[model samples]
Target: MSDKKTLQEIEKEHRDSHFAEKSMQYWRSWGSWFSWGSPVGLGLFFIETAVAAWIVAQIVK
Candidate 1:
């Protein structure tokens, strides 16, 4: 018998790996902000949100 992954299996594995990487990145960023305390975390949160909103607005225009 030969060992081979089907196309669907390969796609699923790639998606799962991508999601895991994104999740790790999110948590690492969150932890970095959390370590800085509430004020700094809140500041960073607002800055990120504003940037996201601006991007969305630009896209909508």
Candidate 2:
């Protein structure tokens, strides 16, 4: 508690220059392998799965 001015009161003078985050957003930032490259991973996973299934079928048959 300052006798002259509180810290909150002093900060209020400069607060007009700052803006709040007003927009609610669902945003994708450009980044790594988990982004657009995920389909390739999924495709590879499916291919590996298919190969394993084929091997299993060959063994069973």
Candidate 3:
């Protein structure tokens, strides 16, 4: 319940914290997923779809 914290004090505390570094690290980790993971996931999805379509075609023939 310490409501006496000044804005400058809060800003100083934030500067001393590792919040920015940790947040950047989090986004860097997800950056790989965006760069490489999405294409791999899409490739798998297309493969599965092709397999399913082929099976359906075989059954219908």
Candidate 4:
């Protein structure tokens, strides 16, 4: 057998590397904005939920 990667294998590797890079970029740029662990993100989420609940309560009354 020859020591060579098939075309599909090469393409898969390239695609996987691209995906990993993009994922890292996303995490660095905007992931914290939506992450529950971040204080700002968590605060925003709680505020939104509270507003929604209040609206529902008003509608149900």
Candidate structures ordered by lDDT, highest first: 4, 1, 3, 2
lDDT for residue 39 in candidate 1, whole number 0-100: 82
lDDT of each: 0.90, 0.63, 0.82, 0.93
Residue lDDT tens for model 1, 1-61: 7599999999999999999999999999878776647788778788999999999999999
In model 3, pairs of residues that clash are none
Number of the top lDDT candidate: 4
Clashes of 3: 0
**Cα TM-score per model:** 0.52, 0.41, 0.41, 0.55
Any residue pairs clashing in model 2, and if so which? none
Q: For candidate 4, write residues 1-61 as lDDT tens digits.
A: 9889999999999999999999999888787777889888899899999999999999999
Model 2 over residues 1-61: C-alpha lDDT tens digits?
Answer: 6489878887986674342322212223222333546776567778889999999999999
Better of 1 and 3 by TM-score: 1
TM-score for predicted model 1 compared with the true structure: 0.52
Clashing pairs in 1: none
